[model samples]
Target: MDAFSNVDSNNRGKRIIDGYTPEPYHMPWIGLLVKDGKARCTAFLVSKNANAKASVWVLSAKHCFNDVLFDEYEDKTINSTSYGLLFGVHDLRFSTQHVIYRTIDELFIYPDEGLKTKDIILIKLDRQIKFNSYINGLCLPDSTEEHTPYEDTPW
Candidate 1:
C-alpha cells in the first residue's frame, strides 16, 4: 500500500482560525510540498511567467525543512530529488486529473535568518508549471511596498 494512502482527510473543526473551506479555484495559488510522496508542508505560488502562463516560484515557511524540526531524521539537509509540489487541489488524499505535480529544482531560504526569524523560504520548480483554472499564482508585493503595513491592505 502507498504511504500516502493512510492520510486522513477528515477535518470537521480544523479550519485556520476563522477560515472555512473556500470555493474551488478561489485560492488557486495554494499547494502542498510533498516529501518522498507524503504531504510535508503547505506552500503558495507567489510568481508566474505571464507569457507562458506558468508558475516559477513558490513560498513556504522555512521550518518545514529545518533539521531541528525533524528530530527523528538524521539528515542535515533535505535532498531536492525527494521533494515535489502538488498543486490545483482542495483535498490532498484524492488524486484527480486536475491535480498537477512538479519536482523541486532549487530552494532559497533567506540568508542570515534563523528558524525563528523570517521563517520563510522560496522554491523553484524543476520545470515551469502551466497554469489552469485550478492552478495559478498570487501577485507578490513590489519591493517598494515591502515596508508597508498590511493591516489595512485589501485582499
Candidate 2:
C-alpha cells in the first residue's frame, strides 16, 4: 500500500474490473512455475528458518504438475521431464534486472491423504539463491485470522 496502491490499468481499450501490479520487492515470495518453456502456475518462496538470510526451497501447488508423469501434457506432443521456476517476475513480457530463472533439480511432493490440493511440492533449485532487496523468502505467521463478511457495515 505504499506508492503502488490503487493504480488503474487499461487492457487494449478494455476496462478492467480489478487489477493489481505488485510493487518492486513488495512480494518477494511470489514466483511462477513453467512447464517446459511456457508458464503454468504460481509458486512461493519459503525458508526453513525465520531469519531467512539465505534460503534454498520453493513451494508450489501440486496440481500444477498433473501432466508430469502422463507424458508432459495431455497434448502428447509436449514432453515435460521437469519444470522451471521464474522468480522476481513483475511482468512476463520481458526480463528485468531483478528477474531470475532457475532450473529445478528435485521435487519433494506431499500427495493428498484424501483431499484436494492437500498437495504441496517442495522444489530444490540447481543453485543457491542469494537474498537481496528484490528477492527474499516468506516466513508464514504462526496463525492467520479467518475472513468474515462485513455484513454489519453500512453499504
lDDT by residue (tens digit), candidate 2, 34-57: 764566777888877667686678
Residue 40, model 1, lDDT: 71
Per-residue alpha-carbon lDDT of candidate 1 for residues 1-155, written as tens digits (9 for 90 to 100): 23234334443234355555566667888888766565677888876335447777889888878653443433323466567777877765566777777777777767645677888888888788778888888776667865766321001
**Per-prediction TM-score to the true structure, in the order listed:** 0.73, 0.68
What does the lDDT read for residue 73 in candidate 2?
34
| Runs in model 2 lying further than 4 Å from the true structure | 1-17, 70-82, 113-115, 143-155
Prediction-by-prediction clash tally:
0, 1
Off by over 4 Å in 1: 1-15, 48-52, 68-78, 143-155
